[model samples]
Target: MLSAVAGAVRFVMVAIMTVVTFITPFLGKKEGKIERKAEECKAAFAAISDTHLTDSFIRLGMFEFGLQDMAEATDRLDALVINGDITDHGYPEHWQAFTDTLLKYDISDNNIMVLGNHDTWGGDRTGDYTKENFIKYSKEATGREIDNVYFTAEINGYPVIVLGSQSDHTGPTFYQDQLDWFAEEMEKASEKGLPIFVFCHQPFNGTHGLPYNWEMEKDADPTEGGIGEHSDYILNICNQYKNVIFISGHVHAGLSNTEDGTNYSSVEKVGNVTSVNLPSYEYFDVLRHGHMVNGTGFVFEVYDGEILLRARNFATGTWLENYDVTIEIEK
Candidate 1:
C-alpha cells in the first residue's frame, strides 16, 4: 500500500509540473512571431555609412553584402538609405560603377538617398555638383530626380528628410537656417497629422575630433560650429522640433550600449545630437578612419504611432540592438 501511494504521488506531481510549464509562458505579455517579424520587415535596411573611399569593385567586397546577402535583404527590406559618400570626388566613372550596383538593387521610391561631401567633388557653394546634377545622376540610376540640397520624404510611411553633405567640414553650415524651411514642410505635414524623419550627413551640433577643426595652433579651442565638433547647439534646435526622427552620417560616429558582455556603438551620436550614423561603403579608407571599425547602419521599424529602432550587423546577419524609441512632433 505504501509503495502504491508513493507512485501515485509522483505521478500527480509530474502532471502538475507539466501543466505549470505549459501555461507559464502565457502568463506574461509576449510579442508574437508575426508581430516581431512585422517590426523587422517593416523598415529593415542594410545601411552602410561614411564609405569615404575611391571606387573599386574589389574594395567594395566589404560592403557587408555580396550577391547572396544583397539578394536576401533586398527581398525583405522596405528600402535603403545611402547616408552619403556616393563617390570619392565626383568621379563620374566611379559614381557610375557605384550606381551600376545600385541600379541592380530592388529599391523603390521608399529608398531615400542623402549626398555626402565625397559625392559633391566640389562643395555646395561652388555649384560644381548642384542639386540638378546630383538628381540627374540619381535619376539615371534609380529613375528618381532629387531636387534641393535638403528635402524630406516618407519611408514605409515614416518621416525622412535628405540633407546634403556639407561642402566644407571646416565650419558649421548654419543648419539652423534650414529649420525654417524644414518647419514649413513640417507644418504642411503636421496639418495632415503625419510623423517626420530627418537624415543628414553631418551632425547638427558637432563637438568631436572628426568634425572638429583643431586650432592649427596647439591647445586652441575648436571653432564653435557643426554639432560633431561642438555641443548642444544642434541638439537644442532639434529638441525644439516636434515629430522628428534625426538620422545622420559623417564623423564616423556611433551610439553604444552593452549587451551579452560586449560594448558596442548601436546608435550614432554626432556630438550628442542623437541620430543614426550609417557606415562607410569604402572597401578601404586611407584617411582618418574609424576610432572603431565594423561600422553599420540603422534599421528603423515604423509602426502606427510608434517606431522601433534596431542596429543590424550585416556581417553577422543579426541585430546587435533593439530599442523602443519615440520621435514625434509636439501638437
Candidate 2:
C-alpha cells in the first residue's frame, strides 16, 4: 500500500512537469522574426538534429519553439530535415507527442526524418517492431510510401538521400545490401550534375572529432563516436562521387571551433565529401561542452554553383554569422 502511494505521487509530479513544459513556451517572450538570407535561391531547407523528444516533456517545449521559428523563418521551405533522434525512446506515446506537437505548427510538409539510435533503443519492443513504427510515422509525416527506414526524396529537383542504421545500436550499422543500394543511389544522383545532399544520423569515422569529440576525451577509441565497421565503406562510396554533401547529427557536439583547431567544428571535409555535423537541438543545460547554445541549426540555400550554409540559433531567432560557410558546386 505504501509503495502504491509513492508511485502515485511520482506520477503526479511527472504530470505536473509535463503540463508546465507544454505551457511555458507560450508564456515566454517571442524572438525576432526569421527571414531568408539568400536572394534568388533555387532551393532552400532547414536541418536540425537530436531533438530527443520523449514521452514526457523534457525537450518538447524546445522542439515546439524550433518548429515555430522555422515555420516563420520564410514563406516557403523546400524541406525541413530532422536528421535523427526524433524520440528519446521508441515508444508509441513518444511519437504521438511528436506528431501532436507538429500539428500545432506550420512546419514544412516535406519533412525528412532519419532514424536515430535513441529511436530504436526502446527495450520493450523488438527491432522489427521499432522499425515498423518508424516507417508508420515517417509515412504519416511525409506522405510517402516508406518501405524501409532509409529512403530518398526530391526537393525542388534536388536529390536528397537519407541513410539509417539497420540495427538498433549506439552507432549505425550498414549492411552490404544497404551499401550497394547507397552506391547505386549515388551513381544515379551524381549523373544529374547537381549537389547531392545525403542525410544520416551518424557521422563518418574520424571526420567530426570522433572518439575524442564523442566524449571530449583525447584518447578515446577511433570508432567510439562514428559509424562502426561500415564507416570506411560509406566513406569510400562518398569519395567516388562529386559534390556530395553529407549531413549527420548523433554526436551532440557544439557549433564552436576547437582551441587547437582540430576536432569539434560543425563542418569538415574528407576527400570529395563535405560533412556537416549538427548540434543537438535539445535544451542547453543538457550539453556538456563547446557552445552550449540550444536550438541551433543550419539553413542551406542552393544557388547557381554554390551552396550557402548559415547557422542560426532558432531559440533566440539569431544568425551565427561567424560560422557561415559556402560550398562551390560544379554544374
Best by lDDT: 2
The backbone clash count of each candidate, in order, is: 24, 0
List runs of model 2 lying over 4 Å from the truth.
Answer: 1-32, 123-125, 258-263, 283-289
TM-score of 2: 0.87
Model 2 lowest lDDT segment of ten:
283-292
List the lowest-lDDT window of 10 residues for candidate 1: 283-292
Residues 264-291 of candidate 2 have per-residue lDDT tens digits of: 6788788889999998887342234455
